[model samples]
Target: MAITQIYLNLPVSDLEVSKKVYTAMGGTINPDFTGDTSAQVVFADAIVVQLMTRETFATFTKRSTSDGPIEVISALAAGSREEVDRLADAALAAGGTEPREAQDIGWLYNRAVDDPDGHSWELLAYHPAGGQG
Candidate 1:
């Protein structure tokens, strides 16, 4: 079967605060999917992100919030490594801070940045063919 969409359930401590940060990161609000307690961020027509409250999030997961950065990173693939670098550059210019310069590793190019809410995001470009432009 082919995948037509992807839904990312992200945990947030505060709904209003997270919404503002995501808005700054270029996410558009969809009232059709929003509710009194949650917001659905549409990254693309086929990609949706559900920002769930912490309490609701904790109900399903059995892990505690870590004191340091999250152990795992989530990345959305870019069409090209140049697009990855461009995205990182734009994000940093738009108040996001870069953890480091975009790095290239043969087939992968990636950069990490913290959104306005301090959520970490990796802007990545992955080439399955094992080469870089």
Candidate 2:
């Protein structure tokens, strides 16, 4: 069969704060999940994540952890440049912090932010050379 959906499981220090910030950025919280230990916040049909508390996650993974910067570049592609800008603004307004300004990378434009829990997210707009404006 084919892979139908995906969920990015991220570690967070505080689930409530993280949920608020993500909701501010336009994600919806799924109510079907039973407990506060984890939440499924949906960004798109195929894009959602189970934001888990550090203690809960550590126990599940059978490992210990420390608070630190994200080691990888996690990204979300926006529907348009305006959408990218809107998300950046909303994220900041929701207590998320921008790590840097948006940049034009010739074919793509992007900006990055650190969520309240320190998970990194890059919002981007891509324009193929021959595509419509």
Q: Give the candidate number with the greatest lDDT.
A: 2
**lDDT comparing candidate 1 with the true structure:** 0.72
Poorly placed runs, candidate 1 (over 4 Å): 1-4, 14-17, 20-27, 55-71, 93-95, 116-118
Tens-digit lDDT track for model 1 on 45-123? Answer: 8877787777776777898643466656667677877777676776677667777777788788888977654668887
Q: Would you list the clashing residue pairs of candidate 1? A: none
Q: Candidate 2 — which residues are off by over 4 angstroms? A: 130-133
Total clashing pairs for each candidate: 0, 0
| Superposed Cα deviation of residue 35, candidate 2 (Å) | 2.8
lDDT of 2 by residue, 22-58 (tens): 8766789988962679888998999898888987778
- TM-score for each candidate, following the candidate numbering: 0.66, 0.88
TM-score of 2: 0.88
